[model samples]
Target: MDSAVDGLVSQAARGLHLRVAQLISEVEQRLRCEVPALWEYPDARTSEYIAEHIGTILNGLEDGTRLGAIDPPAPEPGRTGQLAQYGIPVGAVLRAFRLGQGVILDRMLEEIPRRTNDPELVGAAARKLIEGANAYVDRISERGVVAFQEERDRRMQRRLSMVQEAGVRIGTTLDITRTAQELADLAAEYFADIVTVDLLDSELRRDGAPAEDPLLLRRVARRSVSEEPSASVAPQQLHTYPKGARPYRALITGQPSLHLLDMPDEPVRGSIPESEAGALRVHSMLVVPLSARGATLGVAQFFRCGASLQFNDDDLLLAQEIAARAAVAVDNARRYTHARATALALQRSLLPRRVPPQSAVDVACRYLPAGARSGVGGDWYDVIPLSGARVALVVGDVVGHGIRAAATMGRLRTAVRTLADIDLPPDELLTRLDDVVLRLSAEASIDTDGEAVEDAGTEGDIGATCLYAVYDPISHRCTLARAGHVLPSVVTRDGTVDLLDLPAGPPLGLGGLPFEAAEVELPEGSLLALYTDGLLEARDHDIDAGVARLRDALARPAASLDATCETVLDAMLPERPDDDVALLLARTRALGARQVATWDLNAEPAAVAGARSNVSEQLSIWGLEEFGFTAELVVSELVTNAIRYGRPPIRLRLIHDRTLMCEVSDASSTTPHQRRARVFEEGGRGLLLVAQLTRHWGTRHARRGKTVWAELGESVAFPQLALALPGWDSG
Candidate 1:
């Protein structure tokens, strides 16, 4: 559009090309050392740059310097002139390069036709320059960090591998002090300073309630071992930081930590620097958090100083890495220790939480753990209140009593509670428990043998001996099942101690063995003793002798259960348990001023009338006039079930105070199940009627027979039925 401008641009283009070749040579010559990597892109923008910046640059120079040799259109004279856009030259651009400046060159670049150029090609050149520069800087900084970490991790693993070797010995150990010392020595040597390791769980320290601070892990670790802690830190400080302090939060939280402190002369707040008076020389401290399943144990620290040698970044990184690995090791150890503790706690929970005081019927329970420190045995006892104002006293031993045994005891104890809650008879309760144990065993999940043996026994794998009995207040009858266990002593009020003659039954976990219960009259105030084989299996005595020893121990003229149980247990078991011992005792309560009678059953409808008459006579003898109100309904259901599905020979008993118990035995061992119904069903409603009419009902294992029992509550009748059944449904 402008001819003068066009000619000048043409001339300028001719001149600028000459100038750029010169400028490139000059840049390469002078700055080759500084930026040898910088390169130019071969784009159309390079042509425009040569025509513009190169021409102006040469014209700006005086006579014949390298750039001045080129022909360039002169800018308008005597005016502060900006070069015309198309005729910029090279000397100017060269000067800009010498100043390490790109602005002038950048402005000149913008005037070029960039849209038609490959932007990516240009950007690629730029990024290479940036990355090369950044790379140089990072090598000086983070490279050392990487090296430090690798070295530290290697050293840590090497040291801890030794500790793990020590751990092999440690697991079977009763003394942890030597193991603790060995670990501490490793830490101290690697850190090149004083390293102190404390037992996080010391048996000696009885801290109130359990410590809330997860960082306070000594309880889980050492409390089970020592009576008092030998090493400890100041309780973790809560006020170390205020709310809203960050990265600072990491300081308070249970994390492995290292601290740099400004210590001065004279100890101040337990953190005085080594230069202080009478202070042990400690300059820098490194702490590593030790935890498992997110529970933090005590912090272990390494303290060193730069008084003689400086601590470098290498040392810091190495220290941090080693501490990290150690934290993991500590976590694993804590898990093993806590698992032991948890197992012990469960074992204790099975016993009385606190000692029971003197009571009428004697009760004594002593739980002797087999091995204490490295491993613990599980054995426990309970004297529980039963339905119908009786007492259910039980003693049991999970076989091979260690962690697995302890855990099994917990499960079996829970099973007992569940069966009792449903109000099962003693023999059938054992059956249900046996089923559960067998199922657990078959699943092959029970890890007995301290998990030392991979193929440790099952619920069926490890059998247990348990004796369960219910002593009734009205009849003073002790009904019991001894499942392949020691015979408990029965001491009558006349000072006669007799070993209960037990009919053989398989141990608890052996499925489908016939177990018969032996019922005996307590003769008013007889004391019964139950115990695990740990007592009988002691080194000094054969089992028969242990039983004889128990017989005499029961005749010790003991007044309370605690003494009786202790006397029998201590007499039978050794001071150091060869195995675990579980003991339980109970004294009988004489007939509660009322008459009790039991009526046997037959399949004939005549049996129903006989049952009703039997209930009437016993209730009248007990002076319970209201027994007629509820006794008829309970007897009717049991008799009716016997008449229909039950194959003959049922027994009904009316005890004192109108406690009507009706038992119907059938050839079928298949226990009766209550079918939940829609209100119209008539036939399956007998159990429903019995359940509503009675306080509770249960079943007992008889030889080739099962006794389904129903009891009358409060001598009263239920107002109505969900479904009324035919009268002939009664036996």
Candidate 2:
């Protein structure tokens, strides 16, 4: 069939064969310069391979073989493989082949007029070349499609793996900004040239209200794979965008957006200013909502510019998947932040805002709760102004942390204050506080059947430790006691720091243990440091090392009490203490001898008149004539009671400080009782008479016997002394 035509084709093919190298070179040069898609493979080796393939097609045509009989070149190895390696799509690779085919036919057709004068021969050669080249390009392009699809699938799998990895990395911390930054970084690394994450202001606030439309979005994290700066300003500093902006719209609609980021006619607007867009060289963008649990937390934006491909539906899907996971993480972080803030507030309220002004001691205190990870704990300190210008310095730590422990600490502090008001000794005060804790723990325990029970070792157990010290300015002495507490540190006037060798009683909740009081004569200007275990033990250091460090800090040259407290804390505590810390620093002071006056009385009623006259004269000499009468009457009654009820060695003393004090000491251990005597009774009213003339009166026992003391506020300024003469006999 058409044998003579085939021979004519063969003759023309032989002539074209001589110029095959010329045609191949022309096609290769055209592909290199004209086809932008093939520019990725600019290497000379790739160009040579493409050119040789064109030569194969021309050789098949010259052999006079029928189009079907001329087998298509067994898929040229790695010709399109280069395109797959560079992530060039199958369409781009095929377009390059089409361009090469055009170049070959055009160059050959131009040669037709020179090869033969006949128009018929010229048209016949053009037909043979076109048919062969078309078949050759189709086969090569088909193979390129399979390779490109495989490359796309592999890339998709890789991206999926990246998304899964990101899910693990993001929200690893319960911090909102950090989680958002993780999402942005991962997106820029795997998906886009530029990525920015914006969360709703309400979500960040965790205000528990529905997020409003055109939600106020805050850009928390942004990243750019390109070397260029993302914008003139950082994304975090950009803050909020207008209502109709692209990111806002995503939040309002809870739908993702795919469009040109900087397009003039694009529905997305106002998020990025035109100036910022130009700086970023933004061409295409995908804005996806970060939504989870039926609420939209934020929006994530990805930008592709320059040679990067435009955003497609597939890219939008991937961004949405990643955003979905990140949104949940962000929401969780927000909730935790809110809860932590609440706990922090509760803790602050439970702790003392300011220590009470202590007259006997210049006091400064610090209370620091654990960081967010460990939560607020039960550290507490108080400066209580006890009666008679004495102060009780107390520090306590409830075991465990959080709201319950803080509440327990508050209750214990209250108990200590109540016991202190009764003038109980330090050891006795702590002993009562322990009983209070044990009783509270028992009350907190309720069985499953709704019956009250004791859970001494379980959740109801309130494990706590405390240090209590009563500092008496009058005596210049501090009585220290501990309930499983760290011993107090004493910094002497000479700048020598030493931990008190006080006995460590069992912790407060452990009842029945005797708490021993350690009495020390604290010199005026000496420092007393009382603290909870947190000040002597933390995650980074043991109790012993912390105490040593604290000692060193205290041993420094004398500074102000406040400064000394600050130095000790800075030296012993870490940046973020894992345990709650509390410290109380006090400098002791005492009344000078000029501020005090004393008188010794006989163990007889005859001594009372002289004792009263002596105290009255002392008050007059001290410029406290205003307190003369109250002082004389207090001295008379106290001296009378000491002589009548007490054994021997009766003594009366007067001290003028912020208040006027009258103390009567006797060898007898009997404490005088104040009584409201009946009209018929002239006796049993001596102590009562003293109480009426003073602010307060109380009895404190000593080793020898006891001291009954009465105090009058100097400002009371009672009338002048009047000697009460009773039943005088006439001579």
Candidate 3:
């Protein structure tokens, strides 16, 4: 190109650089009108950026650089990226740059005509100046567009990452509080400066749908970037929002909304305290309803505090999506909590309320339900008073969890008590219980009409384990039998603990397996520990370790059976057991020779007189003289029937404990039944009269013999004994 045109263009560019401040002012004014988006930016920032671009262009022109070789300014790309981050359109940025270039190019072209009189030189300089300015704008605009696109892509990627992170982080557990806190923490990290999760009080309690208009909410969780306590509400605080409030409106409509707190008409000021409203006036808030499965569970509030960008449509949609997932999780946790609570209530109701008072053993028991996740299982313990100064210690566990297991446990416990009333041996009793379980399992497989259900899964296939033990103080022996249950531990009076060497029978419900009973002769004050397997298979330890711990605990000297029970549980169980646990501890008490009297008699009609004489003497000695007539009549009738209808040897025994007890043992397995006698009949009145004269009368059949026993009333108190046998009447 000609030096004259280049020199004139360079001189004009130099003169314009000297007037750069005025040029920048003119560019800023023109941009405010031509590119309205730049008005959102600060006036000083706009002026400074324009001045930088103009100065760079003029410096290149003054250095005699070629028109096509002018480079874009250093700050142009970064400035465009900042504008894109603030959500400004790229078109507006380029338009503002184009308009600023027009002002600079117009000034340089107008100055060139005055510096040179030659028409060709003036025209050439003006053309070169206009071409360089256009090249500069084109290059800078390209850089700005690239930066804007890159910023937009980065923002989109960050938002996608946040959504993916939310999917993984929230709802990680079946706990409502934990899930709520996760939602709050995630939102506070990615979307907002302050996040609060507020659930409807009714939803939290699983108490059906929420009320209309004004809603009562409990703040389950809250998180803030500043980590300071909220001025409006604290965590777990229950507060009510009026009808027009943002949270209330969002829940009522089941829609998400964005609100600018600086708006004078915003209703947030009515819901929060004046101090908090003042502090929040400069921020933006988003209220998203937590709706799932057609029900609105609660609302999540996200606040952009201080200089943070205001919440937009995209932020509202993202918050709504996150709240939707969290709502489902909260609902699941609420349902689980309700189910566990119901199962626990049913289990506690089915268990024994209080141990009965018996002469055989001093018993104490403990029952614990499973942890939160496992729900309530079916573990039960009971101390039932049996006939003839004996007591039954029962601990059983049903498979599965929730209401079905608890109900089945109740039925099994009832079956046990019913079978025990007949004075069945432990092995025979378990056999009967096994049959009952088999019947239950069969019934579960079929419907009421007896048709087999095709979809009946293992839900109805009932399975359980039980340990039944009957201890007799008179014999000082404990007969124990198990149906797929853990062995019972016996702690001797000398603090020696050993698990009973009982046969391991198949668990109940698996029919056709015979259970065997093991007899352990326990001395007076010996401790018998019967428990469900849960005690030996807790979460933290294996069965072997649990057994060792249990043995060690039982071997330690304790003040009483109650203390021993507590000690055993504390040693064996963790804070939150994975399964239900039931422990029964019984200390044996023997009836000494003074508390009982016995005699053998001939199997003849005259034996009745000897039995009556012996019983009267025993009652008199035991200070139960008031019951002498009743005892004499009961003994006479029982002995007479045994000699008349029973075969072979017969013996009579009188227990002076609790109440006056008359017992007749015969070497016959035939059980006597009570019948109403005809008015004119002289025979068959023996057993009927015995039943009428005693408080309770029953016949317990043994392998080789049967005992017909009768107990007198408790109206006459014995000095040293308290005997109240169960009412297991054969009649």
Q: What TM-score, to 2 decimals, does candidate 3 have?
A: 0.84
What tens digits encode model 1's per-residue C-alpha lDDT throughout 1-731?
Answer: 23332233334334444456655544344434443322221111333432443445434422222222332323211000111111123233333244322322332233222322545534543343234223422332233344334545564575566555544533343333444444445555545354544334422133335643332233122111112323233222222223322222333475544454455222122222223312444445554444335554444445554442223334445545554445445555445556667777777866567533322255656777765442556466766654445667778777764567788787887788777666567788888888987887765543454343355543347577678887777666778887777788777778888888877778887888867887887766677777777777766778888777777787887657777777777677666667767776676655454445666677788777777777777667667768675777677777777677767556565555335555666776667788765645556766776787777887655557776777666646444553344343333
* Model 3 / residue 105 / CA error / Å: 8.7
After superposition, the stretches of candidate 2 with alpha carbons farther than 4 Å from their true spots are 1-149, 172-174, 206-214, 225-240, 262-273, 291-295, 443-458, 538-541, 598-615, 629-653, 661-731
Clashes of each: 35, 0, 1
lDDT of 3 by residue, 84-171 (tens): 7656788989888788888888898888877878898988888877787788788888888999899889878887787788889988
Q: Please report the TM-score between candidate 1 and the true structure.
A: 0.51
Per-model TM-score versus the true fold: 0.51, 0.72, 0.84
> Candidate 1, which segments miss by more than 4 Å at Cα?
1-268, 271-298, 302-333, 344-394, 400-407, 410-439, 445-460, 468-484, 492-522, 535-559, 563-580, 597-623, 636-652, 657-688, 698-709, 715-731
| Model 1: worst 10 consecutive residues (lDDT sum) | 77-86
- Candidate 1, 419: how far from true, in Å? 7.7
Per-residue lDDT of candidate 2, residues 262-320 (tens digit): 45324323444445555556677888888888988888888876556566666787888
Model 3, position 430: C-alpha lDDT score: 98
